[model samples]
Target: MSVTSTLGNALSGLTAASKAASVVSSNIANATTEGYGVRQVQTTSVSLNGQGSGVQVVSVSRNVNEGVLADRRAADAAYAQAATLASFYGSVEGAIGLPGDEGSLSSEFSQFEAALVEAGSRPDSDARLANVVRAAESLAGTLNDLSADIQSERLEAEKEIARQVDNLNTSLAQIQDLNGDIRLQIAAGNDPLGLMDQRQVLIDQIATIVPVSVVDRDFGQVALITESGGVLLDGTAAEISFRDVGLITPDMTVASGGLYQVEINGSPVDSTSPNNPLKGGSLDALFEIRDELAVSAQGDVDAVARDLIERFQNSAIDPTLSAGEPGLFTDAGALVDPANEVGLAGRIELNARVDPAKGGEVWRVRTGLGATSPGDPGAGGIILALSDALSEPKVVASGSFSSIPRTAAALASDLLSTIGAARQASENEVSYTAAKWETLRSLELEGGVDTDAELQKLLMIETAYAANARVIQTVDEMLDLLLRI
Candidate 1:
């Protein structure tokens, strides 16, 4: 080959080697970077008259397994959903308290029952009556606190949903911007791998908030769609919106037309409905907790309160109570109507007529609320009847409990067990989904940059660079010899 042609081939080889080395160095540098895809320089062979000339750098392309990436994103979303559910359940369990804890509703109910038995044994003792009243108050306060906590959590979840919606919009906009930049860069024959990596990172971030599917477009552009087949972005991002309801209460429910709804691109989406587009992500889980799980828990507490109110309201249990009049237990010092069963737990209170601290007489325990005169001070009849009323098996109206007759204490225990079971189930799901997500993430990393492979490639690039330099040196020496001749 002519020295000129030889020099040209050597220079082309040198340029290709330099570009390959750059790609290898970049791969090593970003080995640990999150969402970074490994890159390789594409090369094409040059030919002259059907003979090999040299090699030319075509383009730099990122190495990414789209299928694995898609699976990882899906796993991320599922894990986020499970984690959200588990977190909410844990909060509820904390608020409900464990069976043996002092503040637990079950424990307080047991204390009240014990106090009633003691008072029943010594009906004449004002101290025992006072203790019974205190225990009843404690039980009522515990239920009230739990109900409030459930509602508070619902409100917080609503607010969090609003915040997440805003974050989702921002992420979508950023991704769209990057998509435009990448298309422009590709059209200009420039490397767009860096922009593509940044875009992938944004996509992963948004996946945790809501499950999404990615579609590849021409010129390095991508479109995003939700798992439910709702288009989130194509050429531009769609608007996501949510209505925030401040200071939620038990009465505020979707069925009652009190709660706010989620909107996507100006279309109302029922967050609680099965067809929700935002399913399988943290946002969906939060909505479920706020509108469904928390509401059901509050209903359970209200049912317990209704059971208590109804049990004591029976004149057979407390003859002093007139028909329709409240007995020892009242709803905020008033008779609880069966129609107003909601929020009963938050309103449950001890009858003031039997509570001396509330300006009533302790002797009222022995006498009926309707009795103008105090009955026999030593009359253990009413105390025994009250104790029996609490311990006797009775059918509860609350659907949360079995319709079969059970004592008040047994029903409370069952309710606690139910809550505990739900929390346990959620925790188990969290563990399972978290493991799955971690495994997928590990697989994705394994499919990413391999430092050892990159090092080997770097050595190859160095050898090629040295050989090309040798060819150039030989060509230069040959040219010098020709000049000397």
Candidate 2:
């Protein structure tokens, strides 16, 4: 070989070795960085007339397991969905209090029942009658507070959905911009690895909000489509929008103008529908909480209030209460109209006639709302009858509970049990999905950067660099010898 050819070969080897070392250094530097893909220096041999000419650095290719990455993204979406649901249910459980807690609905009902029994035994004691009124008020207040808490949760979920929509839009726009940059880099034969990595990070962020499927396009460009078949981005980023309500009430619902549906590019869509493209992520879970789970909880509480009103409105329960007259438990101090059962829990209150604190006579507890004057102070008949009305098993008109007959206290326990069961189910789901997500994430990290391998590669690069430097030195000595000749 000619000396010039040898010099050229040595120079090409040095350049390739330096590029390879730079790639190794980059890999080691970003070993712990999230969303960083490992890069390798791609090299090819050059030849002239069947003889080795030199080496060429072709491209800096990113090492990634596409299938494993897709699996991890899917797991992230599922985990977010489960976790959001569990959190909302946990909040509801906290608001309702534990089954036997003093401030809980079940506990309040038990206290009321116990007070009624005590009042029945001491019918002449005005203080005991006063305790009965207090217990009744506590029970109503517990239900009202719980109803308000549920509505508050709905409002929070609505606000979160709006925030998520904004985040999703931003991510989609950034991804689209990255797509343009990456495509340009690829077409210009420039290393687009950095842009591609940034795009992957944005895609992962989008996955946490909504499940998506990625499709590769020409020139390193990618198209994003939701698992639910909604196109998020093709040539341009799709717009996501939501109309957040200022306040949420128990009577307001998605179908009843209490909430708003998500929109895609000016088209409205139901986030909870089975066909929703945004399913399997935190955004979808929030929508289900605001529009479905929370709404159902409100309905159940309203049913309980309706049952209480209907039970006391019975002529057999309180003979002195004329038809249509407010009973001991009334809807905000008015007779309950069965037609309007919604928001009943928030409006439930003790009849003013039996609530001394509400400017009514306490003797009305025994004499009844329609009674003109107080009945015999010593008469235990009316007090005993009231106790019987609360203790006796009766069929509830509300469809929220089972059709079987149950005492008022038993029904309250059932309501608590229902809430507990729902929360437990959500907790189980969260545990399972979280484990799956972590496992997938660990696998992805394992497939990312191997520091040991990178070190080994660096050692090889050092050897090549040393050999190339030695060749260049030998060539320089040969040139010096020729000059002396």
Candidate 3:
């Protein structure tokens, strides 16, 4: 080969080695960077008249463990879902309080029962009668507070859904923009590895919100589809939409249009069903809290309210309370409309005739709710009957509990037990999902860019560079000898 061709070959090798060195240096620098892909410089041999002339630096390619990455993303979604549910259950269980705890639902019921017995023993004591009224009010007020807490959770979930939808849209749009930018870089023969890394970050963000699957497309672009076959992006990003219902109530529901639904390209997607498009993520968990979990909680508490209302409203228990008339407890100060039992827990209140704060007499506790006057202040008949009604075992009229007879306090205990069971189950799931996520995450990191490996690659690149430089130096010396001759 001519000395000039030899020089040209050395120059090509120098260029290839320099590019390889740059790639290795970048890998080392970004070793701990999240979502940064390890890169390698690609090369091909140049040909002249079917003979190798030199080396050509082709493209820089990224080394990504696609399988591990996919598994990690799925684990991310599962962990998000489990964590959200566990948090919600923990909140509810905390609000209800443990058995025998002060201010707990069971404690309030027990206090009311105990107060009733005290007043029945001293029926003439106005203070004891007032204590009985106050205890009853406390029990009703506790139910109201619990119902309100559940609705608050529903409202929070509603707002969160809206926020998540907006974020999902923003992320999808950003991904689409990155996709286009990556394609442009590829077309211009520029390295798109950096843009691809950024795209992966955005996709990981989206994965926690909703599970997605990536699909390879031409021109270095990618498409995303939900696990349940909902197209999130093809060539263009799908517009995810949700309407913000600023206020929510127990009566409000998505089915009745009181709550909004999540939409994809203007098509409704059920957030609660097993076939939900965006399942196994935080967004789905929020929907479950709003539409299913909170609603169920409200149902259980309202059942307790219904039992309390009916227990005292019986003519046999309180003969003075006329048919369809409220007893010791009233629904918003009136008789309960069975059709409107959805929010009864929040609306339940101590009957006005016995609530001194409402211009009623405290002696009404020993008399009757419908009694016109304090006929006999020392009459303990009515007070003892009221106490019996509270303590007697009776079948509940509503909720998922068995129809077997239970005292009012026992029903209260059952509510706590039910919510506690759910909370424990959810906590268990959180533990399981968190472990799975961590294991997958550790596996992915184990396969990630290794600084030591990158340094070794750097050493190889340096050797190749030195060899190329030596060849050029030899060629320069040979050319000088030729020129001198």
lDDT for model 3 comes to 0.90
| lDDT tens per residue, model 3, 1-485 | 87878888889999999888888889888989989888978899998877668899888888888898988899899889988988898889887898778898989999999999999999999999999999999999999999999999999888888988999999999999999999998899887899999999999999999999999999989999889988899999999999888788899998888988898889988887788888879999999999999999999999999999888887887788788788899899888777889999999999999887789998888888888898888899989999999988999888888988999999999999999999899889889988988898888887778888888888888898999899999998988998999
Instruction: Report the Cα lDDT for residue 292, model 1.
Output: 87
lDDT of 1 by residue, 77-163 (tens): 888888888888788788877778878888898899899899888888889988988898898888889889989989989999999
* CA deviation > 4 Å runs, candidate 1: 371-375
lDDT of all the models against the reference?
0.87, 0.87, 0.90
Clashing pairs in 1: none
Which stretches of model 3 miss by more than 4 angstroms? 50-52
lDDT, model 2: 0.87
Q: Per-residue CA lDDT of candidate 2, range 137-255, in tens?
A: 99999889989999999999988998999999999999999999998888888889988888999999999899899999988899999898999999899999999988998878878
Which candidate wins on lDDT? 3
Question: lDDT, candidate 3, residue 262?
Answer: 90
Query: Which parts of model 2 have CA positions greater than 4 angstroms off?
Result: none
* lDDT score of residue 398 within candidate 2: 70
